[model samples]
Target chain A: MPKSINPAIRDFLDGRIWLRLHTPFTIEDINQQIEAGHIEIIQGIESKLVFMNRKSYTCNRCENTDQSKFTIFNCAKCEASCAYCRNCIKMGRVASCTELIVWKGEQPIYPTSHTLAWEGTLTPRQQQASDDLTRSQEINRSHLIYAVCGSGKTEILFPPIFHLLKQGKRVCIAAPRVDVILELEPRLRVAFPQTEIESLYGGAKPTMKASQLVLATTHQLYRFQHAFDAIFVDEADAFPYKADETLQKAVRKAVKPTKPIHFVTATPSDKLLVEAKSTGGISIINRRYHGHDLPTPAYISLWKYEHHIQKGRLPKKLTDWTNERIKKSEPFLIFFHHIGFMEKAEPLFQLIHPGIHSVHAAHPDRKTYVQALRDKAIPGLLTTTILERGITIQNVQVAVIGAEQRIFDKAALIQIGGRVGRSSAFPTGDFTLFHNGITYAMDEAKSEILKLNKGGGTNPDELPFM
Target chain B: MNCLLCEQPKQSSPSWQSLIAIEKSTLICEDCSNQFKRVDIIEVGDNIDSITSIFTYNEAMRNYLHQYKFLQDIALAGVFSNELKQALSKKKAIIVPIPMHPTKKIERTFAQVDELLKAADVSFEDLLIKTNQEVMGEKTREERLSMSRLFQIKPQVEIESTTYILVDDIYTTGTTMQHAALTLKEAGAKTVHAVTLIRAASEQ
Candidate 1:
């Protein structure tokens, strides 16, 4: 005979589809749950994740061919031959007999009538796009918001998300990058103070409790299956997420098989747009909420900037740019292409101005340094494209040291420019590219910004007051 | 050939000088192998005469063992075979494995310690059979202490009064090894020595 489960536990475990239970739960309690059929133990740590016959093998997660990654061995725990997936082995080996308790019982219903606490108003373009998203969400159909950089895409997502939350539908706002989640989490929490929200990323401590709204990275979506009623993919066209097929599949797998998926991005690849437009309606927001134009970038040649930085000497124009920003007491972000050059250039720029710092994706102090910049404790930061998105500083100036590098694709360049003029108080900033030679990507980035401006933007000349 | 962990090609210095420093059957490159902290504490208490373990079970070794044992990357059994062999008795002796019960063997599929010996090409007898089917992991330390008689010599197995070299994977608290050594000694083996690949390093 099985005992009735606590409702709190059910709500917490439901959307967590597949999760590992290590210490804290007594084995007797686990056995009782197993008897109750609330969750079936798939495989314990002793068992292999994939059970294979001699002829063929398959991975249940990611669904890749079991080649070099899956190696078979006579397992002592299961007393049988088994294979394991090497691809996701880093995420804790899923061998045969590995104990994976899955949520197999009824999911929790979270009906709420609370209205959104966000008092800010959206622009007419943002309002129209939000309405379109609401219709798409109602019909459980996919939609894409093809907004340009600095076009207030995050704010536009608020109304539709609020509508779904009131109707008791589970909503997930997934981003390809962790930095984006960090940037959006506080704002979303502020907007929906009455809603239970959870933010998840690689190192984030997962709040196992049931949440009406979830913010997660696409990589974190692997542990989720048929979880969300509506999934919104922010920065949908970012690197790895756009290039990697597995992450794309994870987004699809995360939501209920038939539910809606919305993608919000400033720069959408042609293939993504074409595919999305075929199945869903598309809306575009090309102007920033303040009706200001995207910053127009001008390129200047610095033929041997690398040599100059390594020799502890910066080019005169670059030095003058740094000094000018320092003199004006304005915060700035200088984008670098290569990590080695970025490191070498950091100290040189510090000599130019000791108040400056540098950061990269792998830096141990990246989060702290970014926070320092946000608090106005640092005058400027020398960083890689890691800061090109997810960071908004007041009246921050932008410059790309090696804009001609292959790493600075048109989309990345657009994002780098988008870093400027985000706050209404600082609706204008200098967007410059210091390049060895003008490349097609640089021109394409510039033309894209110009195109967005031509679509719908206040005349830059008339914004002199800003 | 490349280092298995870092995948860097093995760098060779002047030939003769490097050859003497390099051990034959060394699978990982020199720098990668250097990361494992070699332990000086080989033997524990009086019950076990002599023991040899290669690496201190530090965080790195813990992670490596986690991948090998729990992750079941059975291929790693080959990675440490040579190192494990050098730590074992060189003299002629019967290699006896600390057997897991049928229940545990069914769950894990392969006995981790036995696989380590097999990869080293050390001839061993799987004669020590586990009598208890209870899991050590789910029990308290007191329950584990009560499990002193969990293993026994297989029936009809001839005890030749010869040397016995017992094999196991980890030596945590020395309980599991003590049980195996005492079993072999009482069964009329002249001498009993044990070899473990990693021993638990006291926490900092």
Candidate 2:
């Protein structure tokens, strides 16, 4: 018969069993056990309890063990090797087991549930895209997933990404805007519940360890050097990224040599498309996911907001449209070509309807104001083209002031229209271009949308829209 | 080190290593060195202040500047700062480098002179602020001269009879330094002397 164990030893063993066997443990239980002296406290260590199996007794270095004669040895070379009973030598470098070692204290761990599962069926176009991404991944070739506005491009990426993660391959999705990264983070986290997903942008919490998947803005790509196995450049032609060669260099530098880079955009630049075609790996999804055609833009003449402001009045058509939206409690965005004009028009519209909110790049609380717009807490938002892409607000009407301005290029106008009619709940909305005269870019943008709407097979002149 | 421009052997005078390379083929020999007195002019008005530079604007200097301005090479700024300190050793005046437009600085992620001055351990003050001017490359010498009038001292910053040493990377026609000095004088500065990395040789 085994000798009766001491009461202190029994309590210590019980405490160890309680900690190791049970997870999501309560602090009250821990405090009770600590007060009973069943736990040994180690100060200055991170407040965590470490449990070791007490039945194990083996020499740490040479893996020799004697279960009946257990002892902790103080050897000088113990720093390099944990010296324990002779049996531990056979176990090889195993440390001696202690019972109920409690850390000082710990931050509360909240259990998070990941339940992001695909609920929607893939449309025919999305199915085709899914097929293409699989083929592209198998062949190790670059593929362009060109989907129109409101076409669940992010959702389609989930299937391929899930496949890659299962195979233990790393994936990165890079965009030019912080807003896009913010929008994609929660969606990605839900889709890959067990996989570690890192969202890297300015102001995001740094991941404690390297992750299998990452969502980062293009600027953040500068820090990575040939790290990712697959790279997806979203909004490939967006400002500062497209205009600056150094950012492009950074992207190229970050991507591994063997990995292929996928470009996703509603409107591809002529150069990018030409390169994609020449490279022989291109896939385009012309139709939106909503099953409705993309909106064809039309121009209305309204030259310079400055002239209207100086006259101590808002433009007649714009004011009438804005007042109707305000009366109906519908949220809307009025985009101006220039910041100066946007600033001038914002106050005039607010005076006409005091409930309306306006925001621009210079606003200190731009993020908060934009969130308010998204939540429909405000009726209207007056803005610059900074809100053109990477932001989604439900049931908002969009109008571009001074659409004929040189700054309002084809791609920009299309992206501004994309801001409207994004959600299935509010699938259709007005997208008007207020201009003194329709410019070539305006005509080009309208035609491009029409072409994309009609199955996208017209030999349209290649313009640098994206 | 050799003179980067003329390929002549550069000898450091007893004072500082940087002064010998400021201008092309223009070195104050040991005998003529006594004639060089530390000028305490607070404001650069009508008279031209003779300046000394440490290095010529050679390929290495251009590469260094390219890294400093475009690549955000913070480490290279340390070299620049040490060179500036050696060149302006005698001057007890506060060092003031030209200010960059806030917008440009934001885009570039750093101010060129701020990095240099911080690395060099010299006291810097915003004595002169840059104003809206045409692109430096697009403007002619006359245009640049007219445009230089825009650099002015802020009203709150009172430079009361204090000497200032103007620091800059390259001194081409001396238009920028001249305007800066004039503005400093207008703000009640006692004297202003210029020091740059390079000064183009005067045609004989």
Candidate 3:
């Protein structure tokens, strides 16, 4: 057999991500592609819960193998006991016999002509971090960007990204939260208008074009293998990413073995910081791109806030706090620990203004509601920790209703406080914690903000609008 | 022999009306009808005229339909069809089984919703066709709404003054049913109601 250069086969198989064989094509065509070395069979994982009789089945997609968790049924079609993994059944039902297919051919050779389109100048901190990142990218060495909140972390990413894209290498910016990816999508599109860029989350329509740049949630990385020349993980220490081992494995699997992976976040875990520092110099920037101090939360005692919500009334202090913002036509996010209490308090808060709405993890209008807040279409939103991070609203004041709840840990409180004063228009705003009593977590969050403010290394005396 | 699904002994016979409709051999004798949980609480909305489900889609129903639809077990459809048939005692309306897109039809040998209607001997016209082959089973409620352009009316359906009961296998979020109802009403349906074998719990 002779090797052939087939462009159609190359286009079909060259995507860095996994492509299931769902296209309208014949088996003979697939065989031809396979013979031409453009496609190969990738075996699915075997059952991790095989019994002694080898009659057990498990799902390899979500790594679910629990006997009780397995959805067992006797299939009359296959005439055998068939089991499906219900955990990831939404993607598609994966049975014991399901075959996972992947492309195994030469990838596309992109031209080194991609240009950065952003005209804004970077801050000194951003420039230094960008240079450090470029050096790391040059050697394909792992790096981290330990920048404070509102420290122009995304801008710091631009120069290094432009260099990598110009060199004709595929790169992905993966975040743990969907909101982060949503926020980055438009910014990245504007920054690299000429290059093909695809954004992949759970419901995002997968793009047909082979993108040189990709913005995706970490969960979407499971479908990729040796895809990116370099991968940047935003919100490196956020939940579901920090707790789930599979997500960490997914990021590792997404990038080629020889490629560099970088972490960028304001609240880096000690372990992450230590790891980054061990490998050469870790680029840490403590100052916001705007020369302003981090917002230190003001602790307010709203004794029995939950109790007041239960009585179908908002605490006078909380109500007054909300009314002030509403009267001034200011947009804000009031964080709650529980959805039930947040919903119960929503109508009472709505009494101040009908536009006030609440959202939780399962709210169907979460995206719309958040967008409205950004567009300032709504007065304010009652929310849970889902909006604690990756949400940027100009001049928005942050308030946590139940600051004493165990759910509002040190990291969560900081992230929620970080939501305030993020935009260039509003470099300083109030971050208030309304609680019956201040917990250690709240204290620690305040301390962390103050520490970052002191160590920001900027001319603190030159801070504006203080 | 015990019931194939519950494996419980023949506890109670099915109602006489349902018994007369099906052969004795196919009778799920473990009081399956006793297990027929009805969600009579109907919420009326703009696009969705009304929703009526015969069986409260519980755990067993999920497993049963999972096998019937995904596993392609032809036998389970008969069980569901029989269970739903005797209980469908409502206004006489033309049945319309939610359709699979042409691409999906080519992928799967048989249509899950169509097979149930066929097994039940229900008179249904293929008046609607799914335009997008995208699966809604795994999508979030927001995704389902955004992707609500999943269906289109078949060009040939002369729907001037006909009643339609949109037939589907399961009703969870009611997104698909609402889309179908909206499409039917837009095509000049006088009345559009939805019927599903089981009603899954509203996660909300």
Candidate 4:
């Protein structure tokens, strides 16, 4: 008789497909599991990843199909010139010869009962969206929560997530940026107090316990296969996911076959809006939960701002904005298009105030700097679009330096504007667009905010500040 | 054509060498080639008779070796083909690539030294077989020196009483080359000289 497979190994590998040998699992246990016919060994780089006729390769895990991204190296294991996917090489090199182990045994049952510890009531707008999402899950159709920022989008997701958990189904909330995942983990855990929730991101330790609710970055979903019964993509139109097709494929590949992928975003792409409309349906919530308008952005023309910053001088208008914020003792964030320009302008901004700092995606102290800003320890920060979303600071004034740059698209600008007026205690703040010249994106972003604000209730002049 | 190292389109001005060698186009561009810090022939003393290295292990060479050996960008083996050919062709000694352990060979796919020689279109003798699986790069200088004999002469292979030049991808602490040379000397080789692509600045 075959020996029983190890429960620990099974739980770890249950839905995590395409794991390399000895990765977070002992080789002996994996081999034993294989002997018991509870594990399946699949080729790391499936033949489907390669285009035979074109002499190109793709990464099966990340769905990276770019011809340039696939590289060939002499593989000792296969004894051939095997192709490996460079796109997801950081996770582990996936070559033709590498064996990916997956658990095909009896899946461990998750707890169907869960407790939502959150006592806060959802607004009527949020309730409507929540009901719409729960209805979409019943019919097994994809849905989009086209809600404005600070509109309790996460609260809307709670009902559907709870419904899925009651059915003993696994649910995933994936975001493109790690910030979003970090932001959701604590909230989701508090809300689903008794549920097994795990947050997966870069460098995160893998949990041995079988988690029913998975909050992961889109990049982390590359390791999963047919894992979640329902996957909700939070910040669906965010960076990397919006610009990269492979990330889109990763999200699709992560979900179980025929399962729906609901999207929750403040500003989704036109393609996503259309896809949702044609499929499950779109549920729009234009109002913030606080019942206030999105902070309308005011334009400030700073022509040759780069030249002035390069010359070790902040532009006059930018200096004025900084002075005003400093005079009011308000914490601020100045967004730049490029890191080089941001760094060049960082010292100039610091001249106005010594504690002002700069941050980018790869900045080593990004977490601390953001935390420092949140704690109001620093006066301000000059940053790239990395801080465009998922960060909430009370009474934080915002500015976009070089707003005319192509990087400041309508979606990005809208999200940046969303950064302000988030918390109800500080309902309104200044949002300045410091631009060299006006661009169509700027006009679209301003009009989009105006349209959303109008859709929320009434004219900003008509409504009193909360 | 794309440059073998950078994979960028080859953009190089025609020099007198390129003009004469019309059939042998440069595999890597001038920009990529300029990064290597070529050094003069330095004699590696002790058990080995002498050693010759083409380039010092500068940043570019380090990156090149990382991509070539670790990342398995095998096309990079041709980046210095012409230089290797020019250096090895003048030597009267028999070319013997420092052998990889059978398991390491499998892990690395093609033997790095063998591919370098193959890319240069130079023939070599497979006279030695590596016996141990320990990688020289991972061990400290002292640990590597004290490690057990890692190479053995292949069965039935004759080590003629002539000079044998051993080829390797990089020369670090020279422990690997010493072990390889000692094995060859014991197998009746007269003189053992080492040729490596890059010489790392020894760790002080």
The candidates' DockQ values read 0.46, 0.01, 0.05, 0.35
**What digit string (tens of lDDT, one per residue) describes model 4 on residues A73-123?**
666777677887766765766777778877789998988998878888999
Query: What lDDT score belongs to each candidate, Candidate 1 first?
Result: 0.77, 0.65, 0.75, 0.84
Per-residue lDDT over A318-393 for candidate 1, one digit per residue giving the tens place of the 0 to 100 score: 9999899988988889999987789898888888878788889868899888778878898889998888886778
Candidate 3 — which pairs collide? B57-B199
Using lDDT as the measure, the top candidate is 4
Q: A328-424, model 2: which lDDT tens digit per residue? A: 7778888877766676677788887775666766477789988887787778888887888888888888888888888788889888888878888
The TM-score leader among the candidates is 4
* Number of clashes recorded per candidate: 34, 30, 1, 2
What candidate 3 gets wrong by more than 4 Å, as runs, is: A1-9, A15-28, A48-87, A374-377, A456-466, B1-196, B199-204
Kindly list the per-residue Cα lDDT of model 1 for residues B63-101, writing each as its tens digit: 678777776667677778767777664768888888888
Count clashing residue pairs in model 4. 2
Residue-wise lDDT of candidate 3 within A1-466, one digit each (tens)? 4356555545534533332444334666766777777676653335544457554544444454444435444433345555655444445555544555556766678768987999899988789889999999888788988787877789889999999888888899999988899889999889888988989898887666678898999888876777888999999989789977667877887888988899998777767766766776368777778878888899899887777789997888888898899888889999999887788998898888999999998699998998899898999999989988877888999899879999898889888888878777888887898888888888877776787788742332332112
lDDT of 4 by residue, B1-204 (tens): 767666567877777877888446767887788889888476866779999988998888877877778766666788888888887887799999998888778866778888899888999999899888876778786787778888899999999889999998888788888988998999899999988888887775
Query: What C-alpha lDDT, on a 0 to 100 scale, does residue A375 get in candidate 1?
Result: 87
Model 4 sits at a Cα RMSD from the real structure of: 5.5
Poorest lDDT segment (10 consecutive residues) of candidate 2 chain A: A14-23
Poorly placed runs, candidate 4 (over 4 Å): A3-5, A48-59, A456-466, B1-98, B110-128, B136-143, B152-172, B181-204
